[model samples]
Target: MHVLPQVDSSPSLPRTKRVFFALNDYERRVFFPEYLAAELDALNGEAHWRTDELPSPAYWQTMMQELQPDVIVSCWSTPAVPFSLANAGSPLAYVCHLVGSVRNLVPRTFLERGGLLTNWGDIAGKTVAEHALLLALAALRNQPGWRPIINGPKAVPWRSGTMRLQPRSLYGRRVGIHGFGHVARALIRLLQPFDVEISAYSAGVPTGLMRSAGVTPFTSLLELATRSEVFFDCEALTPQSTASINATVLAALPDDAVFVNVGRGPVVDEPALVREAASGRIQVALDVVCKEPIDPASPLASLPGVILSPHIGGPTFDHFPHCGQRALENLARYLRGESPEALITPELYDRST
Candidate 1:
């Protein structure tokens, strides 16, 4: 009769939600360090970390069943949420992704089934915009060819006027942004000091919004390209948008116009872009390509006028903690029966890469 002491099973007690960190080593170290993990663990839940490489689908399913996570914080190397696990009435209620493009990490059915999803929305916009400016300035100033000029056999060609890669000034340039998303808006702000005339073209974006932002909105991409001295590709990737920057658009750019892409690559026709760059008609600076870690043998890699960055445009390494903080904020909001920021709607999911 030494029965169990009175157990407090009161309904007033807050329920604990299980949280799973589906991130690899690098992601864990950079995106979620000890302090951030502790912050998450302090929430009303038990936090579990996956330190090893991605597990097999079957293993993931088993783990999901065992832990039955109510929230998952995922990152670059995290495996895609299996369709079966997500669709078959799984306990997964929300997924807070620490980076962009959750298409690879999440399934469409997750949203369709009323599960909440969010990404580090607009947190990296300013940083990416800064990189876009860097690429534009580098291309305009012939940064790719500076090495030979600086290390040449001659001491220095005093008052060198006939440099092979002629430098161009970005000041007072006609800049056209292909999309008016967060990054594009940030670029507009950065370009304001230069007094450049900015025009933008995005399929569904309203002209009034652009006008309010001091931008000239174009109804067509070709029109924007034809008029721009510097064209930035910041459009999202979708089925209809694939290859939207085709031969016609590339051909429309003014001679020597700088084409910078900090956006997805498939939006541009790689072959056409290569042909344009090879012709020496335009300078191309890209942070992305059709294929990631672009093949060295690719023609785009050899062209002197083309400057390529290994897709480093983003909230810089130091800013990764900000993304983690955003994810945590969203998780807290969700736990409080409030809507999370940057909830990935079905439409947004479709619009993403």
Candidate 2:
């Protein structure tokens, strides 16, 4: 039999209270693969809340009042874990959000009451960084331009005597990343083998670390845009950052430069991006859009040199179990009275997407 190192064959997790499944079946299947779920089931306590849709907020309050579970495991579709549900019986001791960003689902009261909140910040960073890398490569190679050929009939020959879009290589290109968070750092490491010049712009990253990583730290967005062959915007969306990438910043890039956005849509000025790409001054690829599903009337849907995906820039179904295992590890640590990793503090939330 094959041995999987990640599965714990040791004693079941010692727990005093119930652990609620604050996610749907699809999410559970992804995060808690069969083996891992079985391992968890073997733990000291039973898993609760297996509903496809979580109970109504009022009913949730009543459920909490009754069961007072010690732990709540959450994911993308989870509703906010209300303060009333937390207690000595349940205490709302910890929440393990398998996905990132608790800004919407996690209520402020939970944080105030000192409940342990954690997200996929422990593992999702690398996966998201890889998505950004995929966009970078697709943009560099002009994947959008050639995509129409695939949509066209196979009646035409793929080989052409004259190529319409000259494929560009990633080797030795100057790459600029707007935010030096986990995704940017992971991207920088991935680009190392390609021998690309890396520079980053983010107030959050220390100058010393950038220098140590062989990444040039550009203090201003304009400078990073002006100097790179390819640029990545991974900035978080905050009121202060909302229109940070305006027309002037986009125009600062050298002509024909590739720009990728795997970050928040609002961080880039939507109208300005549409105008820029329409003018053919710069190339752009996006996994996130200003409006979801891309409005049929939006010019971005037809613009040349623009590639878009429906915001699936992170780990897909197959890799979800890895993220799940990471969450289970955190759950085990909390049951053992240790500080679960990736605890979200106010400062951390402010910096996250």
Candidate 3:
């Protein structure tokens, strides 16, 4: 346990809100630097931090009952906020998450009871879109083959004709995006310079909205896949979207079409995607997979026409401060009795990855 020095203890000031930091040691250092910690300390509150990465339930319960924090700053390693601490009668009112996906750290009942919650939100959208573009370009150029071609036993000639990987270009390509959320929108901006024709399909997103963004909106995923030379999966993970990209969708892509996914992996049928790539019918570049830190037996580990990354598609490590700052800003707003940005709604929560 650690506590920031109280900056104000005047009797006339409003009651000092108790702010708890439910982060492990590593998360604390990464998300809250000294300056950010000082900034948080500047708020009209007392900040108490948790040192344990995996505290016992009894320990957490005891701490919560003792501190009765009005706000909690949490991250990936933090445990789920207990039910007793999230009710209407509890003083705990807000949770400022330093990263995405509050579903693990927060209970749905917390929001259902009028408690506030905020995460990094769309701050990492541009980063994710940037990675999606990288994956597409890499897939078209056959990036995975370069290493083997250069280091293999066969001494291939330096001449361009000697190279066997038939690399392609992104110029004038027909690009189809499966989702029109933040990442997809940012990807559109990046694709403009490539002179690519863009089309998009999201379950309920209006075509008018896509048209306003200067992209054709398809009503069906199959139609989008049929027409696209490059297919991007950016759909969120939800009951409806899970396994939506099945064998039929994979079979729809034009031959040699590059497929990219920087979004949730379960959105696509993993086995179907694997079979498609294994057959050399389509090239794949994925930053996410259905089983993260992928199972060794997964075909993705050995497929030739596939490029896989360990889900490093967004807001790289250096960007932690930005998320921390956003959390601080949201906390400041809540303290000021002003509405916070990126408040997690029930709809957003229902669809979180």
The number of the candidate with the highest lDDT is 3
Give the residue spans of candidate 3 off by over 4 A.
Answer: 1-14, 152-156, 161-163
Q: Which of candidates 1 and 2 reaches a greater lDDT?
A: 1
Q: Per-residue lDDT tens digits of candidate 1, residues 1-353?
A: 01112224358864466678788877867876666755665465556778579788788877777877878888888878767557747878899999998888888988888998999899889999999999999999989888877676685664473467678889999999998888999999999988899999999999999999999999999999999999999999988889999999999999989999998999999999999999989999999999999999999988877999999999899999889888888877887789999888998898887
Comparison by TM-score, 1 against 3, better one:
3
User: Candidate 2: worst 10 consecutive residues by lDDT?
Assistant: 1-10
- Pairing residues by index, what is the TM-score of model 3? 0.94
Q: Which is better, 2 or 3, measured by lDDT?
A: 3
Stretches off by above 4 angstroms in model 1 are 1-15, 35-38, 161-164
lDDT of 2 by residue, 1-353 (tens): 11112333246843355677777878877787777855575555446755746678787767767766677888877777765664233467777888888887666667666778888774666777888888888887788767676666677667641165677888999999888777777888888899999998887668898999899999889888999889998887877778788998999999989989988898899999999998888888998888888887889888867888888877766778887887878877876678888788977777766
Per-residue accuracy of model 3 over 24-54 as CA lDDT, tens digit each: 8888777777777667666656877776778
Q: How many backbone clashes does candidate 3 have?
A: 0
lDDT of 3 at 9: 52
> How many clashes in each structure?
0, 3, 0
